[model samples]
Target: MKKISRRDFLAASAAVGAAGVLTACGGSSSTAASTAGSAAASSAAGGKSTDYPTKGISVICPWSAGGGTDSCLRAFCEAMGKNLGVTLTVDNQTGGGGILGHQAIADANTDGYTIGMITFELATYKKLGTSELTWENYAPLCRVNTDAAAITVGAKWAADNGITDLPGFIDYCKAHPGEVQMGGSSNASVWHIAGGYLMSATGIDIQMITYQEGAATAVQNAAGGFIQGVTVSLAEARSFIESGDLICLGVMDEERNPVFPDVPTCKEQGYDITYYTQRGMAAPLGVDDAIMTRLEEACAAAIEDPDFVTFMNNNGQAISYLDAQGYADYLKQAAVDVAAAMDAVGL
Candidate 1:
């Protein structure tokens, strides 16, 4: 097996440009075939006045299993299972930073048996002009939660560079603008967005590098002196922080994250911006509305379940529940907002 490093993965991201690659796959004819027999069987099961899920439910995770997105969905599924009365099985269709899996679920039958998790890529890839998969192509079900990014410096780098905290780091950058090198996966990725937003706000000139490797690659490179700082979600870098490999500099949220109470937010640091990337459930365009509604309700129930709440809280996730309609509205506004930002940054 190839033990791919994050640097190796992200090198390609910078080279090719991070773009959205998704499409609506399942239509009535295709989905009808996939769902007919199961629907019939389920209907018969319900004829006896039994509950839903006379069949198994498939939740497609567009990212690799065991990654941040997958782990979060797993927690939600465990809670949703109780309300859905079915075995919510997760199918990992990993590729193209989640497009393969996104397409898989998007094309699945909308007969209330198939659902999938949606992430930032749902809007970003499309903006990159890579694919036709846009928010318009998917039925927004429910947003599970929103994650605020954390700007971190590799511990050794911080020590070697003599930067102790957020204020100190800013002073260092001001003293040596453009001398500090920053690395991220690609344009429109969370890292890129965070780096760009911070740079714009601070008026600091940093050599931002983009690689295709992904967040893991960014973390490794930052630790190895390949870059000076990284703007990624705390969850992705949790392990390194625990090992004292990285120091949390600032968060891109309204306030400090409970898990890292000591860390100040961008607002507190005097940068006025909130970069909450909400991850959630979505289906391919043209999926049945009733099924979308059902999935939305299921996710809502899961978000409130104590077990799921505790699990996410333990993992440092913030609860920002949005039902199907609310999710749709958010996506619409996000598209507009991000487009404006990208244009302003000349990305």
Candidate 2:
């Protein structure tokens, strides 16, 4: 797989920013994939309309109702509804570790009435042999959020092991390879891949435990000392961390998270490791470019919606907005990263 340097990514992102505008006519969609292997297929084929969205838009969520992805998508739909002048309904089509719902989204009719949230799991589907679906299966609109994984552990476990910080935790893991048990969300999930990335970067082996139920159970188990720690987002384990039951060793981000400024980054601790679970909105292939542009514009405006911003901030999720082309690029690069992680963990 080819590596996308940050400089090159930035250059491409700049190009997308300058190129992606409100103009729907002949707009260049660099990342939006058409069913015929082109960029953001034409309206003459289907869904061409001047008075589009005269009806409600169905937003498919590929996760459970009460999960982080669901909540975020619901709030975003509300904001986007205000922009699009129509109600956006959330339909949870969850199963197969997000494969079933994802397939449903990709297979949905391209009438511009149905769209869905594509998650980080999309990058791992092909490598996991669960599905052939990728970002190319849909027309990406914009990236909504990114939650960085954290190395959080039971406070008691850390104290007893004299692991005061990330360095100490890494030393302990190196000394006791495969003895440490880290509970990531589920098999092939983003947090589980974070564990694999950690091992690949540090040359240390640790047993990765999967919580099929979700990260909540894993965080609870870690707080109760059933496992050593978890590689979940800070929001998933925020309650335990607040109660002093779980100690965050470090966040896997380039800079410190504003919500938890006290916690340092893994790179700051000399491990230059960064991993995140990304969520974004995308329509099925062949949606009209006019409809896609309208949806994309709504997404851009909705990001600034006060209610949505508050919901994201209160929920401890970071808003990392990216346009269609940028998100498409991100998904493409993520496939490479996830494939490498699959190899690292023998997945």
Candidate 3:
């Protein structure tokens, strides 16, 4: 896959003309028009407030700039701003393993102007005792991307072991218990939980290795043959897979990702394991409902923008858009599921 620079993406987005607008019809007579205009103004004032976002909006990204989350957030924000008719600034407040930035979002004024990108880590921070932050602290706006975890192995290792698919991997793990080391993101991370879930679901034991930096480093180690396999997001392993340095055995999702449709899901391979890292937008708790509605509308339009879709597809990022209420429901279930998995795995 070709790398899409920030500059290139912005240029492409700028080239695409503004999305089409919808207009309402008005009566021909002056008296009728005046009455219609007055009714419209009254309706707008009583319903969704149209005066929101008078100034620029600030989007706090917990991760460092140029990372997957930051890059996707920037692209999404750029597109969203067009719909909102204001600039959305992304501030990278990186520290405390994403806690600082999330806290910033939670602690910011409860206005629609301040929002942030919340990641899967939100489900683990409380369980890990790192912070008291939870999904309840923020009102979810929309879910942008959900990249599923995948089981990938170095080409040489797969070739040497005669493993080509999930069943073969399970057999190999069963035959050589604790011999095949599985590397993923840091301990208690989403990737680590995914690795643990895989083992539990398949009834196989493999030594779990934790990489502090993240899945990218773990994937790099796997491609270099330091480890047998890696349970990381497919996006992180895309380059290696494209170069034939690593082979993705199975994706831990209910359905196969569009970017790698040939790779079967874990369930399709007879293993009932599914896991992914979800990224979405959220505002501080207590934000007005009208402002939330406005934000959600803008988010929906941004995710559907052709330019944004093209950028995400080229970068191997899966597009999973969810509306506000749907996102809230997902967070509730995700909290329960994450807590159970962490406790079972002793994270």
Candidate 4:
């Protein structure tokens, strides 16, 4: 397969965005898709008479209820609804590693009433041969959160091995190669990709283990010494870290996370590795530009809301917001980068 550069990918993605708008406008009139397209075009043409969102909107989440994605969306939608003057209901359409919910949002009527929270799994769906959904399938709205990956070890395991920092951990892994067993959510997951990226960048090798149940189980296993380390979001391991059962070696981010300011970043430890799980809201491919703009503006306000900020801080999730265009650019580059990282791990 040919590699697409960030610039080329963005150009092609932008073209896809334009084509999506055209498809929405020309879709069946009997469907909500057509309404979405026409409404957006009408708003763009200076028609300010349409009172958009007279009814509640349904926001789809690809993950199950009670998970990080679902919880974050519920809180965010509440704040967003306050700004938009309408209720935003979140529906958990879980399955197929988040493909079902994403597809539901993509196939829903483009009429701004239905939107979804697209997760990092969107970038891997194609490469993993699970689903063809891409950034092009949805109209980019705005990014809500980004949780950086962290390398954590069992508290006893770290002390026993004398691994006090990233350098020490790398040295240990280099010396003991496949002896260091690392666990994550699953194969080709964001955590797995982060681990793969770390190995490729530092020339260290370790056995990659997958936990089908989720990162929580994997983190628990690590704390119990069933595994030497875990490459999952710090939020997943926050409880264990707080309990002193696990130690965060380093977070894979450009800067240290505020919730865990005592922990050093991979960059600060001399390795420029940064990887994170991004969650954002996106509407179906033909939402009216006006409606989309309104949604984006509302989302921006929701992110700045004190309640939302408090929710994020209390939950240990990082607040990293990116606008529509910026998010589109990010998805384009992320798809390429994720593919490269997956390939490095022979995924």
Per-candidate clashes come to 17, 0, 0, 1
* Candidate 1 RMSD to the real structure: 7.9
Taken over the whole model, the C-alpha lDDT of each candidate is 0.63, 0.72, 0.71, 0.70
| Candidate 1: residue 24 Cα off by (Å) | 20
**Which candidate has the highest TM-score of all?**
1
lDDT of 2 by residue, 1-347 (tens): 01111122221222211211110000001112111111222122145544666777788877665456776788898888777777778777766767777898999989888899987777767877889987789999999988777899999999999999999999998899668888766566776656666766666667878765456667788899999898788877787889999999999877887778999999899987776677899999998788788888889999999999998898788888999999888777766655654554455
Candidate 1 lDDT by residue in tens digits, 1-347: 01212222222232211221111111001111111122312222213432345776778876554345666777888787766666677776755655676677778776767778876665666667766676777788877777776778888889987887777888888888667776644445556555665665566656666544345566667767667767777766677787888888888777888888888887787766556556778776765544445566667788898988998888887777878788888878776765555554444
On residues 1-347, what C-alpha lDDT tens digit does candidate 3 reach at each position?
A: 11111221121221111110000000011100000011111113335556676777788877654346766787898788777777778777755557777899999888777898987777778978999999999999998987777899999999998999999999999898768888766555566556666765677777777654456667778889988878777777778899999999998778887888899998898876766677899999998777777788888999998888998988778788889999898888778766665554454
Which whole-number lDDT from 0 to 100 does residue 132 have in model 2?
96
- Give candidate 4's TM-score: 0.77
Tell me the spans in candidate 3 whose CA falls farther than 4 Å from its real position: 1-55, 65-68, 288-290
Q: Please, what are the lDDT tens digits per residue for candidate 4 over residues 221-340?
A: 888998887877777777788999999999977787788889999889898776667788899998877788778887899999898899889877877789999888877877776666
lDDT of 4 at 322: 91
Which prediction has more favorable lDDT, 1 or 2? 2
User: How many clashes does the backbone of model 3 have?
Assistant: 0
Better of 1 and 3 by TM-score: 1
TM-score of each prediction: 0.79, 0.78, 0.77, 0.77
TM-score: model 3 vs. ground truth: 0.77
Of 1 and 2, the candidate ranking higher by TM-score? 1
How many backbone clashes are present in model 1?
A: 17
How many clashing pairs in candidate 4? 1
